[model samples]
Target chain A: MADASPIETHAHVLTLAEPLPLDSGRALAPVEIAYQTYGRLNAAKDNAIIVCHALTGDQHLASPHPKTGKPGWWSRVVGPNRPIDTNRFFVICSNVIGSCMGSSGPSSMADDGAPFAMRFPVITIRDMVRAQVALIDHLGIDRLHGIVGGSMGGMQALSWAANFPERCGAVLVLASAPRQSAQNIAFHEVGRQAIMADPEWKGGDYYTADLDDPRKVGPEAGLAVARMAAHITYLSEQGLTQKFGRRLQDRDAKTFGFDADFQVESYLRYQGLAFTDRFDANSYLYITRAMDYFDLAEEHGGRLANAFAGLKTRMCLVSFDTDWLYPTSESRAVAHAVNAAGAPVSFVELSAPFGHDSFLLDVPALDRVIEGFL
Target chain B: MADASPIETHAHVLTLAEPLPLDSGRALAPVEIAYQTYGRLNAAKDNAIIVCHALTGDQHLASPHPKTGKPGWWSRVVGPNRPIDTNRFFVICSNVIGSCMGSSGPSSMADDGAPFAMRFPVITIRDMVRAQVALIDHLGIDRLHGIVGGSMGGMQALSWAANFPERCGAVLVLASAPRQSAQNIAFHEVGRQAIMADPEWKGGDYYTADLDDPRKVGPEAGLAVARMAAHITYLSEQGLTQKFGRRLQDRDAKTFGFDADFQVESYLRYQGLAFTDRFDANSYLYITRAMDYFDLAEEHGGRLANAFAGLKTRMCLVSFDTDWLYPTSESRAVAHAVNAAGAPVSFVELSAPFGHDSFLLDVPALDRVIEGFL
Candidate 1:
């Protein structure tokens, strides 16, 4: 089922010929970026749109995930006749660096022929965009028609616009902030601690044996705990109440035990466990660390407006009212900065109950907004 | 320092002669409650005020904690010249059941002289209130004074007003909800899972040997992770930003590794690690479970007002504007219920940056409100 694609999609892996320079003054070589392309590149190669994937997302934009057998995360927005309109714009979604999804990440084999694990140089959102730029260059597209994303993906889109403003005609960011907040870093810190605390983690070297071996599984418990903590941040309290409330899970009464008695608990446990199967614990640590270090304003002259200075790319920023993770205020700040920089930017705060995850959900208003922007 | 009290404080343990029944239909014999009294009871015993403590809080309200040598949690509110005015009203603070602080919790010994651990009966907010009632009965205090608390402590105060309407003259609930929201349950569940995930947890039987042994420590790592996750919920995003907005922790640059690079991360790590020193992992699980099971309206015919019907006790509710844990809306709901029940009720949402922890902080407005109500 995962092999099925609604449209003709091509997956490609490109190895960089030169070492990728990192913010930590380190360099990574043999950098392999795996990406998927949907629709045809026009004769002029001017209709290409680069789609950045968020944390935990990968290169499966309009097809079923080969591992999870689930439909592409953005199939609702990026397919043919969808908001992204693959028929009109060539779509490209890549597995970000420092991710485990067929990219150069912690789980990828290094020069030593062992998994990079903790040895993988931490990559920032800008570094992810840099890799995407390499892919775009390899495809012979000098400048993209548009660059679009949400959440961490939006961070990449913003980074692209800031770092290489002339490379894209337009930028669309949704439910993302210019920098990680203290609370955001705190939550990510908890997840990292949970993963590192597990004895099974073995200093991120648990990949020595096959993870399928029951006795030698890699920090699944810790990773699941981490995921559970994070999953809560991705949702609104009202959303959780409307979905689960105080409802019991397959029982009319409390079990008087430590089982998942409440429906919310059951849902969280399932989400946590499901996440462990798809994600690498070490990769989780590295990616979250990357996000924690992201500060676009700091990268400039201590002013966010400096990041968007003299930017010609038309920008559209969308925020969800219920997104407490990256709240509407965050987007407003960015919009204000973009405005201060004299950039052509459109911003809107749409009402959604899904919180930070509203960007990925079935938001009709978001669909209309994206269509209008693109 | 812990043994030193500003006022002569007496600690007492009351053993209930009969078994105390629980919401889970289970009962425990020899139910022991540990409590501390500040100031002297008047001739009529009508000047005694029950001051309940929140989760992770204990009986030493106006004294130093025996374990950490820290000042009493609510010392500002319960001291001789404080808002609670210990000189005017005898203040009593008790260790709630299911807590590790000298209470009959998961860490307490059973009839067989073994730690109850997972065998401890799953209790509720109502059960905690029930135990408090027994303690009050033993103290020869009946139908007198007032009941006041904050956070989970506030839950006990509300439970008192509902279950024992005539037990107190007035009820003051601060920063709490009548029922645990789904988001609340989800966070608690994450903490529980983190504790259970530790290999050292050993199915809550890690107390087989001396926990002080460096080679054989009890689930401290898991408990710390759990604490880290929970500590975030107790704070507001604005408060975090104001206190530690991406400030480097005693460093000029990030190490680009899994270390506490930010001041907030350092603070959280210190908090999480320090918590494990005094808290029992299994006790943490049971207490949180109790909180998750709290639902006053569900217990009273599915209407919050039903719980307060025919109540004669005066009610004063306080909520912090930034407290997302039990937001102002929750207190508003309780206030509306009290109003519908034709009870005298006063509700106020104070502007505080501390979030849920505002109840325990030095809020001048809260001090004034408490003084005026008393």
Candidate 2:
């Protein structure tokens, strides 16, 4: 590990020299995809595995978060002898097109060398997959052993088999649905409104680190509120109750004011605040919009099965029992669609205390499913 | 009826000549309780039924809302031929203290003739019940036939029996728990944070309706955001899906920007916007804090059964199966404790699509239960 290059543990950015076609009737040029790889790709390149990330995730799958100095968000599932087993597979996790990591997003430089910000075209899961395809091509990888993801990442993984069936031989999806529900869209909408309502956002022109003028700064408060709201959806009510349980924060009695009286409130506030340091608000807007627009069935004209028509890829769908975000029924729908398309698919509904976040947690059952499926 | 006096049809405010003691160890002088009554109280005065309203609800239980011109929030289960038939019962509903309706709240004039704003003392459910008791005393009622309510109203109903067991003969608590859970407190905290974070909130001092300076006024945006978040919890995922599942809002295609692309988003936005017209942000903060502090067991020396100790009040508890906010299990716990305390209590969990608000909606099963219970 010490002999490995600094680049090995950090992000690997691929500048797509070609224009990327988007689902929103627009073209994005000079695109960059930020990715990180663990374990070496075999000479045949057949051992290469790509990992798609969720809404606010980046490419630091098994390394430390560059900004927060915290462990990687998915460090539990993608290291040596772990579920994905970096020792046996070359795992790659890339920050999606509309994300803030090193990827080409709203915060990235435009053709005129200025941040695109709100001017950036809205992207879709398909568009995100296309960029990742270009990255794989640039790396001279003809095909990958597998593609894995949970939540929004599952959308990308599913899209990969539809668009590039031969690129990835296997697909493993966790805690995902075929598309976003009305409740899903509604929650995301609240987050977007929260960001847009902030005066500091300045019509998404708050990317500049303007210390001179506070109004020109980024929409931290709005972004934090957005995160706080979304954070509530990621966990189960039972989990939150078990963890915090109306317990006061460092007090035996209530403060009777607008303070974080409960521990859960303090936890959510901290989640919102810490998120502002590492993510861009505009990017949050764009990526969530992309997710809201995601409907595999609609893309194939109300036929989700048509997306995987006669697919040869081996796929496994996994859902968490506690994941209200994308309940087991959602995964079952995906499995039915893929199975109807004549693809080899296996489905499992695992039990976990965490909700949508079970895929990233220490769920031994999920680890076994992934290990077996891979 | 058309022959009824305007005072009977509308709200009547009673300025308490005596100081009202609160659970927060503070006394409120010149306390006002705005109440509405339907039908006449019998000579025995035992037929007087006190109906408690939830947070954001007022005394207009079966009448049209003053601002929205919409039917009363719980009109489906009230009125002449309804569950709690007005032909027999002298139904009375008072706007809870710490609420913005005609009651004495943060928006109401303090002793100094200025709004209390954030200076208002923190209130609890017991505090609300105490105010109601004073109102009942003013009306010359000794004993009530029943105390009925849903959600926060249910909290008040339960508190009435616990605090003044001999004052009421029967208690009907619908879709409510004896206390707030961590998830409940967490959701509330998000709303409070949203309101406080808005610079326009000005530490809850944004009560001025200044036409010259709009920004110096109330925290509309923050309050709207709070409502949007809270509104989601009021409906079930299945219901939201059935009502507005992936349906676009007056558009042929996605706008590719931050707009209400989905009907659910539009619906939520409308709910948030319309809520700002009638609700005060400071009252929302105070009431939510009171709700969070509600723990019957904690107040009864860490045993819920103690709240109903040797209770003579016949109680009926009903829960909506779809209500994740206050699930059926919560009601079951209450029933168990009351039964253990030798109180004649009936418990039923009814199926409803609307989640926590099912008690307010047109559910025939609930109507029957209410009718039979009373």
Candidate 3:
């Protein structure tokens, strides 16, 4: 694998304390955002692309992570000669406001120098995008060439096109929908409950006593169960059967005991444990809440078409054949709304063995589509 | 729901103290099986149809559960006018050897008068079938007209045809596989680990503690998590989305905190909690072990075709389009093996939004297929 590009130091932090009134008659304030950018802006500043990250992803889109020895989540699609081609376009990725990675979240120090925990204002997808817009103004960007993202990132991309149509020239959404499905929310809630049910969770305030409370609150077992459940959703049954069909874990005969007797079991355990290392349990709570609160058309009255009223941005929507999480029907709904708004749009369902995670995996077709669009 | 049919008094028990030599050279014994029959067996015994239950299901397939207020699991399919019409078929549903519902399991008393707990020998799918075969002999039945089941029950149905082709005339396997997939074993292991990790489990010996040891050993929270995880696999994403599309749990707005805010969460919790009342944690361990050990093709020299060698039984296999647990490919594999054996067989992938549980759900197409075949 290629080494990640070095982190740029020119990024800035912005804080806002003014309460932003919401459609639900609620107000959120005291938001702090950290953002980073790469490449140079053209005279017209139209080459800017904002990359949104998924549930646990951060702003390190094209750089090596500060703690983990891994490259940025989107390095494959954003580097030189890559789909987004960072050498030719300015790329900006921000740590989402409700995330734990150097952004305002439950883990961040509060007004009294204590961790915020559950004290942070509840945020939505629009709220995260709203903060991104503020960051865009801080960076002096007027128009974006495109806003691109998958999963939660895709939620942000859709939010930008709907909430701030004039700021983006194009939109690309992958493996996401207008809102979290009931099943999706249900799985997330299970994970959250697992964390909270842990005795160490201490009502989400373990950061004060220097307690290993997050470990407990995060419900490692519950989270592991949750991750295992979610992981199944990310793969096609065909993929799973092909990859690990009746394959025993480190044994030729069944141990008939409660050991990890299958490769799939080992894989799921690794995923759950690895996830806990970088992700804040509280961030999971907040981000899933934001996704649950998302309903683009609902914000613009009940008419979905009205959400994209007069939008001019070209939109490329991609759905995977096996991605039951956000099935093809959802993409069709978005395409319908975009069409009603007379916006330039393209949609395709790509054949992939992987399910919802296909967008993040190596899919040459996805690369080709993105490259062609760019 | 209609009341469960009264269980007939032809209950029989089978015990094997010596370890029964398995095809793998491994031995499993001290197996005691409990089973009950309903309806009258014809003189020819051709009216007998064994009903296999899914994971956590018991011999009370068409009878009122003695402990819980719930009716038999297959009540809908085994009633007077149902597909496997009890009025015509002498139904036999056994509590598989590894289960705890009136069966000799970890909860059964040993000669020492203490709960066997973890002392129960590890059982396999074939072992369960063998025990059932013993029961069939005790009842003086030379052959069965058919074996019908869904999920793990379906596994037993397939096992009957593969292991005792001469003893069965037709096999109706639904929503089951020839062997448990690696993913299936992995999920089971997670559940097992959850139970074992509970401090109160006391190494599965909680039954004799004179306290609510079952509650702890049952790992209610962990089991709930496990059930929630497994429940996701039981339904198609389309079904879940249609049933509970990101709707809040009794509220119109997101709680923005870590709580069961979604209806899906509430539903999953109900599923998990209700499961504990009727199921044993140790039984969960044993049955999952049996499922993981089930690879008929592996037992017959790694050739699936060999497992069905010279099979004389006709087979009717039904798979749901959304049943990811045992996808259509699995059924195809079984059908292919049966065809290789030159046995009459038919396969159909039924259309249903419900996932693996479609076999149990009221799908008209499934009814038509069963009615036509029977």
Summing lDDT over every window of 10 consecutive residues in candidate 3 chain A, give the lowest-scoring window.
A1-10
DockQ of 2: 0.80
Residues B1-374, candidate 2: write the lDDT tens digits. 21222223556898988878877778877688888888788888878888999988999987888878987776766777667777788889999888888889998888887788888888999999999888888889998998999999999999998989978878999999999998888888888888887888888787765423544258888889999999998999989999999998999988887778789999999999999988889999999999999999999999999999957979999999889999999999999999999999999999989999898887888889888989
lDDT by residue for model 3 (B1-374), tens = 23445545356566755545554454555557777777788878789988888888888776677778677776676766577776678888889877887777777776676777887777778877877787788778898988888888888888888889889878898888888876677667666765664444668876755533444344566556667667877887779878886677778766665566778888888898888776777778788878888888887888888888858878988999988778898899999988988889999999999988898788888888886777
DockQ for every prediction shown? 0.89, 0.80, 0.54
Q: Please state the error at residue B39 of candidate 2 in Å.
A: 1.0
* Model 3 agreement with the true structure over A175-217: per-residue lDDT tens digits: 8887777767766766665665554466777564564454434
Candidate 1 vs candidate 3: which has greater TM-score? 1
TM-score for chain B of each model, two decimals: 0.96, 0.95, 0.91
Q: For each candidate in the order shown, give its overall lDDT on alpha carbons.
A: 0.90, 0.87, 0.77
Model 1 Cα lDDT, one tens digit per residue, A248-345: 99998989789999999999999999998789999899999989999999999899999999589799999999999999888899999999999999
**Candidates 2 and 3: which is better by DockQ?**
2
* Residue B355 displacement (Å), model 2: 1.0
- What would the TM-score be for candidate 3 when compared with the true structure? 0.91
lDDT of 1 by residue, B131-250 (tens): 999888998998659999999999999999998998978899999999999999999999999999998898998786443465535799999999999999999999999999999999
Find the candidate with the highest lDDT and give its number.
1
Error of 2 at B327 (Å): 0.5
State residue B281's C-alpha deviation in candidate 2, in Å: 0.6
